[model samples]
Target chain A: DQQVKQNSPSLSVQEGRISILNCDYTNSMFDYFLWYKKYPAEGPTFLISISSIKDKNEDGRFTVFLNKSAKHLSLHIVPSQPGDSAVYFCAASALPNYGQNFVFGPGTRLSVLP
Target chain B: DVKVTQSSRYLVKRTGEKVFLECVQDMDHENMFWYRQDPGLGLRLIYFSYDVKMKEKGDIPEGYSVSREKKERFSLILESASTNQTSMYLCASIPGQGASGANVLTFGAGSRLTVL
Candidate 1:
């Protein structure tokens, strides 16, 4: 059973446009959600995160919105750049477990067309 | 910066061969994890360690085992290599207690293994 799911396998967007990526989760215990960006040959790096208490969190060009009632979250990147092309993974964790047992979604490959 | 280093960037082995993937972290983090990433499957946890000589199985620990004899090093072992085990293996580390941001893990580049 996949606790987290990223329905879209891939997405393509033009540069300087807004890109939205969606994710869903089945576990209600998950209170913290995070997004990670991964390049072809590198490890996934932290991008932005949102706590269940808040509906949204923003960092520079990236913004993450959480809808706890719907058990869904979305990541938005404005003015997408060519460098933003990579796989984005959505992960969730609870309080004490934190990063240890994080459940990760399949991932969505984002291609920023230049 | 916290650095997690995987001993090998790539490896190839035949069936039934015993394989070991090593990971070391420079930060004395109490939490260490091993995850495998495959196409269409994302990242799945294999094993994790909280402290020296203490380990816990993750979501997918069927054909794998782990070791953490020291605070800075963790090892993943494949008792018998099989084609199904071929994939990218990643190691990550995080501090035990702190702000929520500390939950962010520092990951190694990854080790791509091919079991034929």
Candidate 2:
């Protein structure tokens, strides 16, 4: 069973619009959440993260909101640009494990068209 | 800046052949992980090491093994390469403790293996 799930396989948005990628987890033990972005033939780069203690965290145009009660998290990118097109992965892990077992979602491919 | 380097970017091998994928991290982080990413299946952990000479099996350890001979290197080995084992392998490292409470992982570019 997949502990972390990205329901959408792909998403598309127009330039200068907003792009929202959603992720949900079945395990309540996950207390730390993160988002990573990857381009073709490249490694994933950490984009943003939010601890369970807070509901939201923002980094420049990228914003991550956590809904602990629902066990869901969403990443929002405002003014989405064409360069934002890539696969986004959602990961979660328990802090005490010290990043030993990070559960990653299947990933959502985002395309920002101009 | 922390960087994880996977020596082989791509490789091709015949069935029953032994394969080795090497990874090294310059950050000297205590935790190192080997994961394989497949289409639709996502990143499945194969093994992880928390300390030199110590290793732990992750979700998918079947037909795979790992080695951590030193603090900076982690190696993933395929005893007998099979067609089903063909996938992209990614290596990552993270510190044991952090001020932010959440440790971030630095990833290598990844190694794609093809078992014929």
Tell me how each candidate scores on DockQ against the true complex.
0.73, 0.75
- Report RMSD (Å) for each prediction in the order shown: 1.1, 1.3
TM-score to native of every candidate shown: 0.97, 0.97
- List runs of model 1 lying over 4 Å from the truth: none
lDDT, model 2, position A89 = 98
* Tens digit of per-residue lDDT, candidate 1, span A11-70: 999999999999999999999989999998788998988889999999999999999999
**Could you give the fnat of all candidates in order?**
0.62, 0.73
Per-residue lDDT, model 2, residue B116, is 100
Docking quality tier of candidate 2? medium
TM-score of 1: 0.97
- CAPRI tier of model 1: medium
lDDT value, residue B72 of candidate 2: 97
lDDT (Cα, 0-100) at B84 in candidate 2: 99
Give per-residue CA lDDT, model 2, range B20-101, as digits (tens). 9999999778889999999888888999999999999998999999999999999999999999999999999988776343
